[model samples]
Target: MMGNTRELPAPQRGDSWNTYECATVLCAVDGCDHGACQSGPFFVVSISLDEDKVATTIMYSSDTGTWSTPASLDLGFIESDISISWMHGVLSGGALHFILMHDDARLGVLKYDLGTSCLSEIEPAFEIQSARFDSHALIAPEDGQLGIARLSGFNLSVYWREVCHDQVATWTKSEVIDLKKHLLASNPMISHTELVGSVERTTIIFATTNIGTYMIDLKSLRSKKLTSELRLFNHPWALFPYFSFYNPDKLRTRSI
Candidate 1:
């Protein structure tokens, strides 16, 4: 039950806190192999969106024990009429990915590049433009590229970003998995399904159905029911994967 007692500094734009979109990530220091350990130097990045479609980012460094100046970028789209969903952001390929949503519809994805300090928009594939925002989940980098998984009815479609030698990038449909064939055999009452979240750098995904929640392995095409009863309070976008690490050698020496 470890926690950070230090509080983050307020955003430079005073009213930015009123927005609902924000993400915090702990990243390993360069050339360090500590793997997210607290003893090693690391960076804590925090980002939030302003009402004017600009994103402000502030970073805290363990080495300096100070927070960096807030960096701002204009998202180049007007969303004053719509609201962004309050959901966890995806970090991949040296950038953070957030969904721009309006009601039940997903307008697009906003990407913030940490190294370059640039903000850009990623359009959804044409085939999935009609799908609701709740049916999609941004996957971590697979084979060095970011991907998105969309659940439409009982079928899940995975798409990957492909870059050509000329530096142009595009999204390509990689594969599709039929959940009906994998899950209906055991839980036949599942009438609706929505993507909840995904594990970083893996094919495992968490999904919710009319019956309950499930942990699915896309690699093996297997589904495991995590809960028997549906949890109505668990909104698809609000759920995130929690990861923890510990040293076994140090743990064994502790007096019980």
Candidate 2:
């Protein structure tokens, strides 16, 4: 796994009000990792509080090393309606989707359109029946569709957006993998696992517990242990593309 740490600068006079405060409150430790995205370039998306108005702002860097001015969305989101998930967002179909934990105990998918600079919310296709400990992830798999995984009990409920081009996407049940039926006998610790990351297009889910990290094949129901050392800390957002592992410049480019 790749590890990264960042330091926030002090609030400046011309900066947005609560710029430092929100960065401190929302991005404590690895929280910023959750709000960030990287493709050909890097971009950081953040919610900023300015004069009591909460607006989303983004700073992006291209192949060039310099960062552009922070751009804020014209509209604002409700502070009480949706709580942002502290997981790295899935970028697909020209939009970035962040998992939203709603006030009514439902998961909301917040999509920020890069083309239109619009923010919209999509309710989860299914109710959240899993326990609080059960993990949820938004993935852009190799098929170029938006995927969601809910690891509840002994099964992982996989949901996919079947029609990706529609204004209102359609989500359908993909598959349910029963982990306990396959691996619990070998490692009881599989009972308590959280999704940390995945290898895009590889059809493998990377999960970790106190014991170590393991990869489960989405099709074969087979799992392979990747690490055996006990994790000192678990940062689910501590993931970057392996192809870009050696390029610090790309990773450093866009951070909100």
What lDDT score goes with residue 160 in model 2?
81
lDDT of 2 by residue, 1-256 (tens): 2365444332233665455222111121222233333323444445443443344545333343333344443324444444556666666676677776645545767676765667666666755523355677777765667788887766788888776555666778866787777557667765467777665545667776667777777878788777766341566455443433344445656568
Best prediction by lDDT: 1
lDDT of each: 0.70, 0.58
lDDT of 1: 0.70
Give lDDT tens digits, candidate 1, residues 120-233.
Answer: 777777665557644777788445567788887888988887778997878899767888998898878778787777877677788887778888888888889887564434
RMSD score of candidate 1 (Å): 3.7
Which regions of candidate 1 are displaced past 4 Å? 16-20, 31-36, 75-82, 132-134, 228-233, 251-256
- In angstroms, the error of model 2 at 54 is 3.9
Residue pairs in candidate 2 whose N, alpha carbon or C atoms collide under 3 angstroms:
none
Runs in model 2 lying further than 4 Å from the true structure: 1-55, 63-81, 103-105, 129-133, 164-166, 229-233, 239-241, 244-256
Model 2, position 228, has a per-residue lDDT of: 63
Error of 2 at 172 (Å): 0.6
